[model samples]
Target: MQAIIFVRLFRLLLGRQGPLLLSLLLWTALGI
Candidate 1:
């Protein structure tokens, strides 16, 4: 489903930026 595709995309991003991107995402979530 869509969730599976999202997870795959997230894993691909994590493989690239990893910590920086993760922190940015967390901060954005907290900000929201």
Candidate 2:
């Protein structure tokens, strides 16, 4: 499912820029 993939990506980016990536993801999701 998309949620699973999102979680995986979240974990991957967490070490680098988790908050930034999370905000971007949420922003994109809301934009669509």
Candidate 3:
């Protein structure tokens, strides 16, 4: 399913970008 693919992509991004990705997510959530 699409959700599974998204989870896999998220994992890949976390593996590659780690903290940078997490910070970006927080900023996006805060609308900054």
Candidate 4:
């Protein structure tokens, strides 16, 4: 369940300045 959402977010953010933003998002997600 989480993996699926992670993958979708990864794809969506891949084109952006992703490393920092991605880590932040992943952290926030996990924090939830």
Candidate 5:
């Protein structure tokens, strides 16, 4: 369920790749 939502949100934000990647990377790094 989490992964499914994540994929959806990921695609929703795809147009802003730079910010999206940075945010995802930051969130992942924070262990959230």
Candidate 6:
């Protein structure tokens, strides 16, 4: 399902930026 694709994307992001980028994205979304 498309949900799995999102999980993969998150894992890829974790590999690249470790966890800060994830929090940054979440914060930006919450702010908007």
Clashing residue pairs in candidate 2, if any?
A: none
Estimate the TM-score for candidate 5: 0.45
What range of 10 consecutive residues in model 4 has the weakest lDDT sum?
A: 9-18
Once all C-alphas are superposed, what RMSD does model 5 give against the true structure?
A: 3.3
Q: Report the number of the highest-lDDT candidate.
A: 2
**Model 3 regions more than 4 Å off:** 1-8
Stretches off by above 4 angstroms in model 1 are 1-5
Error of 3 at 7 (Å): 5.4
Better of 4 and 5 by TM-score: 5
Q: Residue-wise lDDT of candidate 6 within 1-32, one digit each (tens)?
A: 98789778888878977679778778976996
**What's the true lDDT of residue 12 in model 6?**
85
Tens-place lDDT digits, model 5, residues 1-32: 89889767777777667686868767997999
Once model 3 is optimally superposed onto the true structure by TM-score, how far is the C-alpha of residue 1 displaced, in angstroms? 12
Candidate 6: Cα lDDT at 22: 78
TM-score, prediction 3:
0.55
Off by over 4 Å in 2: none
Provide the lDDT at 1 for model 5: 81
lDDT of each: 0.82, 0.84, 0.80, 0.81, 0.77, 0.80
Model 2 Cα lDDT, one tens digit per residue, 1-32 = 99999799788878776888788888998996
Per-residue alpha-carbon lDDT of candidate 1 for residues 1-32, written as tens digits (9 for 90 to 100): 99789768888979967888778878986996
Two-way TM-score contest, 2 vs 5, winner: 2
TM-score of each: 0.55, 0.56, 0.55, 0.43, 0.45, 0.43
- Misplaced by over 4 Å in model 5 are 1-16
The runs of at least 3 residues in candidate 4 whose Cα sits more than 4 Å from the true structure, single-residue gaps closed, are 16-32
